[model samples]
Target: NFATLPIVAIIGLTIATMGALTSLPMFWPLPTALLSASVAAGGLALINSIGQMAGFLSPYLVGWIKDQTGSTTLALYALAALTIVGSLVALRVSRSSAVKVAGPA
Candidate 1:
């Protein structure tokens, strides 16, 4: 499955931090790879922007979850669940014809 490694990495995050960190890079090129050459740059830009936004907001979200729950455990679990959902979406995208590379013109 396309999401297999990422799902594994997410689970590893709750265990060995370094192992998860190393595996996380394995999917970094996925967004650009899914785009056709004609739209690669713009697609990558949008993807990067979204990623940056998530990175900026994720800590605040986790902190808020922690405040509401009085423990970081639930926050971490929520983050992990969200990450798994993201991976599944990526897998679906990878399978969809919309992202297939165009034939030579």
Candidate 2:
């Protein structure tokens, strides 16, 4: 599961590097001064870490719910709905509200 982290980092870095180089402008401070290659690399690493943790935990949590419910199909469906709602909230709503919906962490 954790293996994906390295892969994501590699891929994200490669893409970001190519993008930066292609868009790189000849200037005193550089074109995209606000976002240097190092910062982009760090952001990619952060994303990879968070994604790996979520990927590892999501299935385990869903399986545990199924075991407790004694029905895998129902559990998956419930989880799907929850996932959709969660994604919507996470992407659009205030994080405070999302945390409230997510409950005490």
Candidate 3:
């Protein structure tokens, strides 16, 4: 239902914020990084909004695929394929070139 939207947003955004806070220290002097806190925050929000577009479009796309195929099987595979591809891409992320500003306790 439509109520799921806000709930997903709430959880997703909290996790995203935690991720940003945890990772910011690794961006010390990168060309795209080294940003002020506010600038980084605004950038994160912008990126999050763009990524959330999938939430709106993916369901509709899956439903249309279901109508065409007469089954949820293909739709489920499509979603699973996306997750797999994302995991593969994530595996390729290079180690951070910038050192952490805060050392572990």
Q: For model 2, give the 10-residue run with minimal summed lDDT.
A: 24-33
* Alpha-carbon shift of residue 6 in model 2 (angstroms): 35
Whole-structure CA lDDT of model 2: 0.57
By TM-score, rank the candidates, best first. 1, 3, 2
* Model 2, span 1-105: residue lDDT tens: 212588886887687578646532422222123335556566556646976887788788878877898766666576668656755654453333221123376
TM per candidate: 0.68, 0.39, 0.50
Q: Which candidate number maximizes TM-score? A: 1
* Selected candidate, larger lDDT, 1 vs 3: 1
Output the lDDT of residue 1, model 3: 27
| Candidate topping lDDT | 1
**In model 2, what are the clashing residue pairs, if there are any?**
none
What digit string (tens of lDDT, one per residue) describes model 1 on residues 1-105? 212598786776556567557656766677667777788888878878998999999999989987898877788788778877987887887678446555899
Candidate 2 deviant stretches above 4 angstroms: 1-38, 85-105
lDDT of each: 0.75, 0.57, 0.62
Write down the RMSD of all candidates, one decimal each.
7.7, 16.0, 9.4
